[model samples]
Target: MDTKFDFGEPESQNTVYIRRVATSTLPEEIREQVPDLDSMYAVHDAEGEQLALVRDRSMAFVLARQNELSPVSVH
Candidate 1:
């Protein structure tokens, strides 16, 4: 393998990723708000920084679009 591969992400200045997050993995303070739900959706930026947490996948996509960001599924 003499060639180097650039398997890196493209320049996505207006892009975001949406994925499911288990409530059990969240901090105790955040978990207390959604005790009835098992999991939720999360919106993250290109740098993998969490932007928002919503109750459903649809909502997460909607939020990204409203903010003028392209949403991609992480799964």
Candidate 2:
């Protein structure tokens, strides 16, 4: 069975998304700074603008809350 819930748009005004980013996808300038890590976490606003890139998922959430923004996992 399939069910659909029209919950409408999320609170984009104050919501941000968290997702994992492959180090390889980053520019060479950034990759050189973290040669020991394979991946990183990114925090982005609801409109898809990247706000920050951190070393871990938890840090991303913390940064968002510290700035009074709601954090949500994107994937």
User: Per-prediction TM-score, please?
Assistant: 0.84, 0.84
Give the per-residue Cα lDDT of candidate 1 at 34: 90
User: What is the Cα-based TM-score of model 1?
Assistant: 0.84
Residue-wise C-alpha lDDT for candidate 1, range 26-75, written one tens digit per residue: 99998999999999999999889999999999999999999999999998
Clashing pairs in 1: none
Local distance difference test, candidate 1:
0.94
For model 2, residues 33-65, the per-residue Cα lDDT tens digits are 999999999999877989999999999999999
What lDDT does the true structure give each of the candidates?
0.94, 0.94
Which window of ten consecutive residues has the lowest lDDT sum in model 1?
A: 6-15
Query: Following a full C-alpha superposition, what root-mean-square deviation does model 2 have from the true structure?
Result: 5.2
Clashes of 2: 0
Counted clashes in each candidate structure: 0, 0
Model 1 residue runs over 4 Å out of place are 1-11
